[model samples]
Target: MRSFVRVAERGSLSSVAREYGVGQSTITRHVAELEQALGVTLLNRTTRRITLTAEGARYLDDTRTILRLVDEAADGVRSATDRLTGTVRISCTAALGVRHVADILFAFQDRHPGVCVDFRLSDVQIDLVREGVDVAIRLGALSDSSMQRKQIGASRRILVASKEYLDRHGRPDEPGALARHAIIRMSNVSGSDRLVLHRANAEPSILPVGDRLLVDHGLAARRAIMMGRGIAPTHLWLVNDLLEAGIVEQVLPDYSPEPVPLSILFVPGRARVKRVRALIDALHGALRALPGMT
Candidate 1:
């Protein structure tokens, strides 16, 4: 059943065999035996690839549910007296993973030494189910409505630049003066041309920024700002350490871009697994402890 699930998801018998440290013939025999017992064609095999039959697709769902339930039942009983032991696969944005999330996972592992953490970092959002990720720490808005998620916190974003850059080019006291200075824009964010800033006891400011440098990654933009490239809006967690070290200063202390939400999204029934649940609980608190998160 485990082999079938891997074969269905990966669509390669040899790949599954390699992962399990077994021969291709062994994997083939396992699938053949399962097919013979079930009395159904589970997959269509060709030279190039294997595709699942309709029956196979339905069976895959049931298999996943059964596997999850079995793990939950076993782990639940063992966790009462024994140490929890399993792998918790997690996905997180690259910057946050480096700046904050990685430490959280490390601390979690310290507490549950028997548990293993599989951490993956990517700027691009990945399909949690296809990637076999138990949970994903997402920034900004979430698009998948079908997935179960918990709102962890929000990261405060602010306009910032290096002290040297501010000294070279005069600081903008008002939103209108920004047009005179170079703007470092994140190309990945939607509507990079316009910036909306909010302040207490004042109407929100909507300003159009002319980009002097464009970067997609948070660390890349941080590098640009530190080199005195230009002023850019960035998450406080991304540069909080630098800010404290006097490497960079907030461009406009009074105004800031809207705080981006931090969320933990998990695959259905994954939270029932003891290790995954433990990690999720640890993340909920640790993520909120980040400098800008609230």
Candidate 2:
């Protein structure tokens, strides 16, 4: 089972053999024997990469489950003091990871000294299970199935502008007044509907925020805002530094949207190993130091 799984995961007989302290032909024979025993051709040999057959694809999930159970049974007896190893893949936004999660991950690595993490940074919203992500630092609300969420912090979508820009153009008195001004639209959002604005002392105004200027990355949007180009509805964390530095200031405070929950997400069926939990706790600790959550 070990030889079969290793070769499949590594996608190379020689690589697996080297890692497992065995000869290449030995791994090849073991895989062949396993395939024969299961009566399925599990691997298609190739120089570059291997693609699983339909039968192999079906078997791989089951194989992973069996192996996980075996490992847990062994570890349960040894207890957590035995130390945790292997990797946890976390998908998160690029801006947030750099601004915040990176430090927490470094702290986790320092404390654990055994577990390693693969932090995938992207703005794309994806399924954790299908992408082989052990965890996700998800922004906004999640409406997916078969996943649990734990809130580490909270953030509201706030409108922002550089002090210089506000000084030149003057801050708008109300949401409807934004029509006369330029705005930064993020291409990062999945939904394309107009932004809905709510004011504490006035009626809600739903503005069809058009594409005056589109920025793909969050940091780019921050730069545009800092350059006095346009006002942006941005996550508070991304603009925290700029706000403190007086490069940007909050606008339309009364009309800012409801605070969005920041969550650490995990898929079902995988072992909630001690290392995964430790990393999540570390993230929570870091986020607690931020303004809104604190």
Candidate 3:
């Protein structure tokens, strides 16, 4: 299981084998043997990337849980093992990875010096099996398919404008009025297909609006909105600090967004593992402890 986890985390068969002082072919043989034992193919090998099959993805989550238990038991022979002594390879978007996720990870490392973390931050989507990332913090809604996920945090899209911009143009009274305002927006595969604006008791209205500034990254969009360049439909979590500082005002409050959100995604086997479980549980505990969670 450790070898399998290491290969999955490292992504390249050769890389994991080299780390363990073996040839790539040997690592390949080991993975093949494991796959045969499980009666499932875990990776779809390609020249460019290794993709996880649904079965493989599911296996990873559980494998993670099993590994943690084994480690915890080993630790019980001596220490309590608050120091979860191993390397955790995590991947998340560039912006949040640096600002928020990295903070939490670094703190985890500090408290558990026996454990090391290998983190990769990028805006691009990655294949977990191929990239060898143990966990991926993905933003926005999930797909209409079968990948396991947990809520690391809850996030929503809100209309926001700089104080200067709101003062100059006035806040939007309703979703319909946004048509007349300049907007900065993010449209990606991970984001919603259409925008839904909600009021307290009334049904939410869907809008098809154009953007003066269109970006794929949340951080850049947030920066533009903070500068008062244009009003923006943004990820609430990314702009939480700015909103609190009174630098940005929430507009169209009555017509807030519906249930678009943020989540942590991984192959199911990883979620079942002890180290991964520890991280997932820590995230779940931390997030639920946040204000205004449903």
Candidate 4:
């Protein structure tokens, strides 16, 4: 089954055989046996490529589910021993990974030294299966419903400015008033030049904002704001220390951007892996313990 699945995915019998450290004949025999037992042609082979039959496509889905279930069952049995040993590949946004997740992963590894962690930090979403990523930490809404996910926490988006900037330009009492003030825009946060502000029991307002400085990274935006560039909306956790120290103050306190959700996402089939589960648990615990998270 594994060999057949590999062949279907790779579309090359010789490549699959080489990967398994076996002769091409061995893989051919395995596929032949499977087709004979099922009484169906699974693949159409040509000198150039291999294409799956309709039945083969359907059977491939079933095979993947069966294989995943078997792996999950085996993981469950191994997890009973309370020891995890394996490499876990994880993906996460760059800023969050460096500022938050990396520390948690370090602590998790300290606790379970047998487990190795491979971290891929980037701003873009990656294909979990194709990239062999065991798990991903994502912020905001998730569009992929097929993956398994757990909401770890919520990130409140608050508009803030350095105390010096606010004192110099005067704070905006309403969302619309922000149009007149300089704005440090985080381009990655919203694709538009406008900022959307929400208020309790009121219609959301879209305010035109200035683009004195535009940045693609959250940390860069935060730094610009700290240097008194302009007012901008940011995750509360990212500037909690500055807020506490009175270096920055919230603007238009009555209005806020919609809270973004923080979630741990993984392919459904691999969610039950012992190492993946351990990392997920650690993430949940760590994120919940952060300031401003309930």
Q: How accurate locally, in lDDT, is each candidate?
A: 0.89, 0.78, 0.72, 0.84
Best by lDDT: 1
**TM-score, every prediction:** 0.92, 0.79, 0.71, 0.75
lDDT tens readout by residue for model 4, 177-278: 787888888777655488888989999998776667888888888898899998988888788889999999999888888778888899886767777787
The TM-score of predicted model 4 comes to 0.75
Worst 10 residues of 2 by lDDT: 269-278
How far out, in Å, is residue 282 in model 1? Answer: 0.3
Which 10-residue span in candidate 1 carries the lowest summed lDDT?
A: 125-134
How many clashing residue pairs are found in candidate 2?
A: 0
Candidate 1 TM-score over all chains jointly: 0.92
In model 3, how large is the Cα lDDT of residue 56?
A: 83
Look at candidate 4 and give me any clashing residue pairs: none
Candidate 4: give its CA RMSD in angstroms. 5.0
User: Candidate 2 local accuracy as lDDT?
Assistant: 0.78
lDDT of 4: 0.84
Per-residue lDDT over 1-294 for candidate 2, one digit per residue giving the tens place of the 0 to 100 score: 777766666667887788567898999899899899999899887778766778877888788789777756755764657676667778888888888888888888887777878889988888775466778888888888689777876776789999999999999988878887788888767543367777777777788777888888888888899899988888888888888898898988888755667887886655356556667777767776765552
Model 3 is weakest, by summed lDDT over 10 consecutive residues, at 285-294
Question: Candidate 3: which stretches are off by over 4 Å?
Answer: 1-82, 143-148, 189-194, 269-273, 290-292
